[model samples]
Target: MEATSSGRRSKQIRAKKRIEQLKAFYIHLAVFIIVNIIVIAGAVSGNMNNGQSFGEAFFNFNTFSTFIFWGIGVLFHGFKVFSYNPFFSKAWEERQIQKYMDADRDEMKKYS
Candidate 1:
């Protein structure tokens, strides 16, 4: 009974931590959107003040550079929060470990 209770507590703690990570990632995304909007608006206005047309100012790379760069960081953060590793997952690692162990066993049988 105590072991089950402890296991449940451990799982609860891990879940709480995961929830916190998700919340932090969401906050980061919100801040990224808010800040980028302000930055883009400022850049557009600055460019227009400098005599560029509204369309040119709005479409300029400088106007969205911060959004693009910071968005990359936000995307990475989201991926990390969600455990989205394309190249290496827990199942993949386990399969690789099993494959190596089987190969070693086969090699040992040949030696025997």
Candidate 2:
């Protein structure tokens, strides 16, 4: 039936979108790890060149600041890709549309 084919197509489209979201999240995670490692290594080397010991350089605030700040961004990206935000969901949009329609109807009734 046409309805059955339409339902199947809808499901396929949703699955494809979910797959793309997952792929993007994975790429984000990989880049976060690689870039943080490079940043930390560079900071450690720079600190040591400035006469600090290896442990002092590795544990300094400057070394982990990039990881901490960029980590917050990564956390938000993970939430956007994997979690549902009820405030912006389709159901919320539908409810807002109905509310506006009801308000418009009441205004028309008042005028008439």
Model 2 segments beyond 4 Å from truth? 86-98
Q: What's the lDDT for residue 83 in model 2? A: 76
Lowest-sum lDDT 10-residue window in model 1: 78-87
The TM-score measured for candidate 2 stands at 0.76
Best by TM-score: 1
The TM-score obtained by model 1 is 0.86
lDDT of 2 by residue, 35-61 (tens): 999999999999999999999999999
**Which candidate number maximizes lDDT?**
1
TM-score for each predicted model, relative to the true structure: 0.86, 0.76
Off by over 4 Å in 1: 103-112
